[model samples]
Target: MDLELEGKNAIVTGGSKGIGKAIAKELAKEGVNIVIAARNKDLLDATAKELSKETNQRIIPVICDTGNSEAVTKMVNIAIENLNSIDILVNCAARPLVKVLNHFHLKHRMTIFGMI
Candidate 1:
C-alpha cells in the first residue's frame, strides 16, 4: 500500500478531530509530513503528538480559526515556514451556517456566501 507520498508535505484544516484527523493519519502513514490545523490548541497538540508517534512522520499543530482570513494567512505562513512548500491542502475546516446566520446581518450574510 505504498502511496509513493514519502517526504511530501500537506496541510489539513479542521484536523484536530474526526474526518480531518483521519485523513491526516492516513497521509502520514503514507509517508507525508503534515500540519494539522484547528481552533483548539489542546486537541491539536495532542493529535499531532499521537499521529507523529504512530506514523513516524512530522506532524505540526497550528491553532487556527478558518473563518478568519488573517488567521488562515498566518496558518499558511506557519506551514510554509515549517514544511518549506505545500504539496497538498485538505480544507476540512467549517462551521455550522445556521449558527453563523443567527449572528450576522443580511449584508454580512451575503458576504458569507460570497455574494457580495
Candidate 2:
C-alpha cells in the first residue's frame, strides 16, 4: 500500500521498545525519516541500527526522558535538525510503572513494554 509518506519526517517518543518502536519501524518502512527518543542510550542506539538496516531508512536515536520539559524541547530540536521537518509526532512513550490500590487489594501495572 502507498502511504504517501515518502520523505516525511517524524518524532516518536519512548520509541526504543513496544508500540513506539513498532510505530518507528512502520514509518521507516513507509519511507519516513524518524527520530526515536528514550532514556536508554544503548537501547536507542541498538534499535536505531536495527531499524535502519531493516527499513533502509534514516533512523536517529536520542537519549531522552520525556518527564523533563527541557528534554522534550531538546528532542524536538534534534529531530528537526536530523530529519529537517516534523510532519508527524508519535508520543508512544509512557511511565514504566503504576501502582494502584483497588477496593480490596493493590495492583501494579507496567506501561511501555507492558503498557504499550
Candidate 3:
C-alpha cells in the first residue's frame, strides 16, 4: 500500500470530479501535494478544500481550459508554483466539446491530450 510518494507533488487535470478526483485522492492519501485543475472554479475550490481536509496534504486548485494552449501553459506554471515540483501527472479531463463554444469546432479531440 505504500506508494513511497511522501513529499511528492502532482498535477491532476480535470480533477474536480469522477476518476480524476479519485486519482487525486489516492495521491493525496499517499502524502503527495496535489494541484488539481478544472474549468469550473467553484468545483475546483470545493474539491481542493475537501481533499486537503481529508488527506491533510496541500491541495491547490487551478482554473484551466485545456482546449487553449495559453490556458494549459498557465495551468502548468501555476501548478509548478503551487506544488514546487510535478512528480506525477494524471490527465483525466474528459471535456465535452459540444458544451463549449457554439461555433468553435475541434478538428481532433486528441489535441488536448497532446498537451498532457
Error of 1 at 86 (Å): 0.2
lDDT of 1 by residue, 1-116 (tens): 99899999999999999999999999999999999999999999999999999999999999999999999999999999999999999988989898767767776777778664
Instruction: Give the lowest summed-lDDT range of ten residues in model 2.
Output: 103-112
| True lDDT of residue 64, candidate 2 | 92
**How would you encode candidate 3's per-residue C-alpha lDDT over 1-116 as one tens digit per residue?**
99899999999999999999999999999999988999999999999999999999999999988888899999899988877778899999876867665334343444555433
Among all candidates shown, the one with the greatest TM-score: 1
User: Taking the candidates one at a time, how many backbone clashes does each contain?
Assistant: 0, 2, 0
RMSD of 3: 7.6
Candidate 1 Cα misplacement greater than 4 A, ranges: 103-116
* Of 1 and 2, the candidate ranking higher by TM-score: 1
Put the candidates in lDDT order, highest first: 1, 3, 2
TM-score per candidate, chains pooled: 0.86, 0.82, 0.82
The C-alpha local distance difference test score for the whole of candidate 3 amounts to 0.90
Off by over 4 Å in 2: 99-116
RMSD each, Å: 4.9, 8.1, 7.6
